[model samples]
Target chain A: MPEGTFCNRTPIQSEKALKRLLEDTGGKTYYQEMKALEVDRDLLWGTIQKTLKSRLRTWLGICAHCGMCADSCFLYRISKRDPRQVPAYKIQSTLGEIVRRKGNVDNAFMHMAMETAWAKCTCCNRCGLYCPHGIDMGVMFGYLRGLLYQQGFVPWELKIGAGMHRVYRAQMDVTDKDFVETFEWMVEEYEEDYPGLTVPVDKQEADILYTVNAREVKHYPEDLAEAAILFHLAGEDWTVPSSGWEQTSLAMFAGDWEACKLQVQSVYGAMERLKPKRMVGTECGHAHRATVVEGPYWAGRPDGRPPVRSIHYVEWLAEALRTGKLRIDPEKRIRVPVTIQDSCNYIRNHGLKEITREIISHIVAPGYFREMSPNREHNYCCGGGGGFNGIGLYRPQRNQALITKRDQLLATGAEMVIAPCHNCWDAIRDLVEEFHVPIKWSFLKPLLIKMVQVPEHLRPENS
Target chain B: MYEFLAGPMFILSLCVFFVGLLVRAIWYVRGLHWQMDRVAYGMYPGPGIKGAARSIGYWLLPFGTYGWRAQPFMTVAFFLLHLGAVLIPLFLLGHTLVLKAATGIALPAMPARIADFLSWAAVIGIAMLALRRIALPEVRILTSAYDYFILLVTAAPFITGLVARYHAGDYAFWLSLHMFFGEVLLILAPFTKLSHIILFFMSRAQIGMDYGIKRGGINGKGMAW
Candidate 1:
């Protein structure tokens, strides 16, 4: 989190100065590869034309430049209102360039445009929900990125992320063995606490199919253990998706639009095999945003499978809390002043704000959620949300993005920034260390599990 | 020569402006092309009774009473521009007044406003809106050159008419300037964002009506308020 960690000492300002971007492109701009893929040029232009025709007016007509967009961003609030970074404005400029091009810009424009449009926006559509005009900058950015990718404007980080998306169906290409290993680790940890608890994977025909971001398997495995304990206590009939269980779609974040559809289709393909009634996104924002909002729009669903019935964990857990199936005493908040860092994807993707807080109130200090200015759908991106954390080049700009966001965490004087999404946690975790705060960060599942009051019948007599 | 051109431009601007606004109203009432900006805001998330009521008010006001009261300076200014659009051209130049004088109702006195001071007020109001769009950074930020051009396109007739009526030309000269500007705006209105003026009330209404019927709706405040 040292501001220097993301510093590119020489900031490239103009098209001529961005030669590093071209040679540094990690060797493929999709426009060069597009004709070879045989993706139709006319169809590409038509979609671009249609999207602009629909949005340009509102894009130009926004009356409230209240900088509410910066407020709504997790990156900004987490960075203490850095005043330098605003995703909406970043989007505005890129979109402005595209609009200025009138849809006839060069591959170079596409390259810079892609970085700002595709890489910058998570396509979570959080700001759109809060916009006074309800402008869908995410949707606009998505199409603009898709158009750039189609025309050979691919960036290096986005290019590699897209490739990873192909390999693992998420950003980091962890294998099925890795998923199983992660689950086994969780099972072993959970058994030490509750010997009877079953953290079963690929348990076909289970009522619920649980999923989590690849980040959990790779980094925050403690969160997975929390899942096992909570489900064991609740006696829920859920199974880890044997295949395609990772709920992080970095493809969506990378501006790899085609890969995004394919990644979600794989999850549904796995869902069909398990045939679970419902699929829950593991605290990851873009994954759920894609699953509910965008995934349904795509044409194919691996074997042409229909879209799955999906909702986030907050929805399911909050429902359980409301119905008396899940219980927790707020007074037993062992690790509070616990402030909930609302993930932008969670709010922008699903408008699940009320439910997110309602669930937290059951187990943690509801007051622990320090109101990051513009939390919820209006909440800022965790500069690292989406695939930006993995984008090596945008790191300092990412740091710059989180100036106010860090200040918000410091203001609360809390020990933890409880983010549900893995990338959100990872990005904020970096910021925490760098901005010089030691707030232990985590998702709701692990925290909930750690605080659960073991029911009398469930208590082990050995103690 | 003036007879033929003046008659049509005069009647046509009046007809198109009046009729185009009506179609825009219907489109609004019916909620055509609106993707529901009202829904997510919690002002009216659903297209239910409340939304419908809101839409109805939004539509009727521009055509009826509240249109004047809501944005009086803007409404009055627009009303004047629209009035000058019709009266000056057809009456002064198209010979409609001479033609209709036999049939009865006389055109209202516009060139002569109440005590003359209100004439300056109307001119000043148009200038104020134009200045606001240019001076206010947020409003300025939203507008494009095309947008500013339309505002100027609209202002010219009144401005030229003000000059022509006071100093140089006959009613015909002022009439031609008014008709020319009116016709250009009408023709371009459908294509540009300028159409939003004609389109806003109806869009709001349809969104309002849509919200009126729904079980739960998103309104203006980004919540279910």
Candidate 2:
């Protein structure tokens, strides 16, 4: 209620422990370790000075406080229109205040900023489209997260996520060896069905150097099999790099800039080593964003691109369908009422809206595909972007935020929601779980594999 | 006091207004690290410029963007405030006469009645915006004493100009106050949030090019949404 203070409705279950964690900064847990870490005023201010570049300074200086961004944000809309959820207010109160104070902030302020950055905003970049001045709170929040990460104020999951990238070069504990073995094992399971199906590993000069999200490698090895199946049937020269195969960057989500650079560089390094004509990442929005869109910048590539051309899985799917490499079986196409969950990282931020539509046209039967209102770039986030889905501290807010997407889904009258991106798929799954919605969700790879018209030569002998 | 305000003070404020904006623009450009910032400015000039133009053009129109369309009343007030702030001062007969007399440059002027109407509209617009800042919870939460101060300072010139034109108060007193506040507004323009008049274009262009070049906003993609 007071000036310069956030509403901070994110409930802390253990107040005493939180207090102790804040005071001592000395627990073995990631959250406690981050909480207990000492505030480095000098480093904080130094980073602030370094990051106070043209974009940020102009955005901060030019904001008219018109509150247009309030309605643009799903968090603001779904939280009963909470003032604190307003994108302009959220960024201004946190990053705006930090810069105003020259980063001479206390531990409490840092924690408050951490909450606002990770919880209130999802870095969806939706609000950027609506701002009259084009002040992107998403980009600013990302920069703020970098500052927060430097000061050890990141959330437990993201901190761990970043550490995983540092330790394993992947978001999970899975190593390069595990990834290669998992792909081999998963492909072998499907080998009998599609004989001679193999996941080409570390194959140099392959036309398409395929990469994947660690989630597919860990929880959903079947996704790897599906990708391999599709590529095999399409007769494309694709190989998965043993190293840098994990495309999603939790480091990017964590606002760990150094880790972000490191994570993306590994992928770039693989691209350089493999000499693949083009790289296609698995169905993950942020992975594409991390590796292709922002990674080049982070890795300091002069052309602002990776070593080889990188494309999203949707692009590859669309291209394959368009080029007659992969044909959808009309009999097997989706006939039930279905809609799409457009991943903001790609659809909005990267302008891959129509590419997904191309894929949808092929896979969905006539009259089966229903479009969500405000689809494509105008579509809302899955309420679990920017590492919101994984953080334990903000689960309530994250779940509450799903109301926007839920209402969108319900209005479409779709029994199934095809979420091409992994984050959207997971968020939709969580949304159905939390809200008990009847709609089922899926990634495109599995759906495509089922619906694709297998060539006579590529098809299993018995089938 | 009248002579100083009308002559030397006005000149001084004008110099500060232009030089201040120029210096601020230079500082902003200089602050940009070429590697970090400029690399994302979009590789293709054609698409980047197109995106930038579209971005600025859309926001200039009343209810042009999704944000504006959502808040109809605020959009009306915003346009009224900006149109009056830009148009009335530049095209008013009295201001043109003053300009012609001072700089020996004659300029076309709008009708007196239209100028009066715009001044009234501007005042009402400012009042509406100020009311929203106080009334709307979302806007109010972001507002501070500094925001209020900015509003008051911005409104002073229009209010005093209206009073002086209509002979509603002491003519000399109101006229002097109008000129003084107008100069103050000019002096404050580049240094405060008022700099948005110029920087708005820059911010929009940066984001536009960011999407246009880096993302697929160009080549007939991402233009619709």
Candidate 3:
């Protein structure tokens, strides 16, 4: 493996800059919230009382304190086994400390608790698989985040993203007109390659309602083009709603359940108005988890029933291949050795490991695919999940936490690493630059375009 | 006094254990809401019941979870200890003999030699766990005095029984002491972290149903422990 193939240009925000951003956001900051918690201890206790339920209590009680989960934590692994960074320690300090103090901790205690709950652990849920008790520490951290959120201690970027989602129905604050313009622009660019490619915006009664990460519009419009190419090639009836297209929710990451609810509700509202038979998300893992898994829980269905069936783009592509709707040109199959980096949301949280591989296998030739040691559900998080990447305040610590993951990627000895999740892509991209790992990163969409072909008659120009 | 401790106090401790467990169970369940996270389409790839069974059954074996796999020696030690502690109490010949005499109901007991070996294994397991708590920095930080207290309470009956059965102490005196410790452990079971004896299955099942059945595409293998 080579070093520093990509330049390490990611800005490390200074503490003062972060504080200034927080002040500009204009609300009670975490310090103020902690002071408030110190004065009215009952408020903190009341929140804990409402939130602490059976599963969490069971997790707290059942943990044998065996320290077996410590080695499983990437942060603990990379940080030279610092006891404070252990997954068990994360729970013990935040939830356990709260319970021990009965919610009457001081401002310093709250500050330490916030650091442990937010910056130390990514809420990746990798530790759950390692737990003999099957305790989902990710969910526990979420509940912890909720308490911290009440104290106005959420990470600044997450706070801003959630605020954007609540106010503008987009995490990046891309308005409806901006979104439509991006789609039109991308469609125009895509038509050069696949003539007559149309990026449908707010197409009513479409079979599939496609959602995207806000980053797709703001940073990587070419990803949208790839998705457009795949959908167009597959001959699938899909539409991207002008509103509710931004799929990823930093609100969920920040523990702002209200903003999270607004994001989900907006998606569902768009779906209801469009009446799509089903919903599909782009190759973004957390977005899929939010829209399909946690969204309904936070934002209820309109009729109080299940929301429209939600599927990941990988699943959609694999199904298309299975049914012969799409074909991969074996000649185009990636001949070089390639490995996959499973996003925590998709692998550990959703169990899409095989499907992820299957999608890659179609694009990559047999025996060319390499599995990372401890791949799939056991894969290490990219240290980007759970809103960790969104918070610029923890940038240095976040990069430090990626050491184990950097080692894992290098160990694979693959030239290209396929990361389906946007967050994973961003994290791996940074880690590759910082650690100077030689692996080139590619997402599933571009790979599918490279390796798969749409039949001539299905092409708009041919028709 | 022997009769009072063995017969009346034993029964009283059993009552406290059962009643306390029942109360806690009710409290746990009553707090639950119907709204839950759901499976995305094609997430669960297998049957729900089988996945749930696999989930609960997997953790019952040594090296079942990823954590246990990482620490093989400790996993085996804990497995052996759990096997002995759980099995011998229910199936030891002496225990069944006494229960049959008292209640006119009995479960078939293991051979005497097997029962004796398990009892010893349980004691050794408890000792190993205690040593680990004392020696390991990670475990030491989390280990409270209450944790050690609970360990003693749990191990006392097994040790005293071994003493009585092997005539290491006066048989009658050791038997009475054994009965006393047994009663105390019973009374403490529901009120202490020992409640995991009952709660483990529920937590595993809840995890299985949520991750295994719902999110793991019906088979819940995605999040299997």
What C-alpha lDDT values do all the predictions have?
A: 0.58, 0.83, 0.75
Give a tens-digit lDDT track for model 2, residues A25-141.
222344544444566778888977776798788888788888878889999999889898889999988898888888788868888999999999999988888888888899899
DockQ of 2: 0.54
Better of 1 and 3 by DockQ: 3
- Tens-digit lDDT string for candidate 1 (A366-391): 45555665565456567666566766
Candidate 2 lDDT over residue span B1-225, tens digit each: 777887888778878988988887777767756346624553578877877787788788887887788789898898889889999878999788776766677889999988988888999899999989988998888888878888888899999999999899799999999999999999999989888767877777677777777766752354452
For model 1 chain B, where is the 10-residue window of minimal lDDT? Answer: B213-222
CA displacement after TM-score superposition, residue B6 of candidate 3 (Å):
2.8
Kindly report which residue stretches of model 1 are placed more than 4 angstroms away from their true locations once superposed: A1-103, A118-133, A299-308, A334-336, A366-369, A411-415, A438-440, B1-7, B14-144, B156-180, B198-225
Q: Over 4 Å off in model 2, which ranges?
A: A1-28, A33-35, B34-39, B223-225
Give the Å error, residue B62, model 1. 15
Which portions of model 3 show Cα errors greater than 4 Å?
A: A1-40, A301-306, A458-463, B36-51, B219-222
lDDT tens digits by residue: candidate 1, B1-225? 356445655556556756776665464444322221212222223444455455445334433322234334445545554444435444443234533543344654433543134434446656766665666443444445765676677676556656665766676777667657756766655555556655544334333443332211331222221
Colliding pairs, model 2 = A25-A36
How many residue pairs clash in all the candidates, one count each?
60, 1, 6
Task: Identify the superior model by TM-score, candidate 2 or candidate 3.
Answer: 2
lDDT of 3 at B128: 86
Per-model DockQ against the true two-chain complex: 0.11, 0.54, 0.49
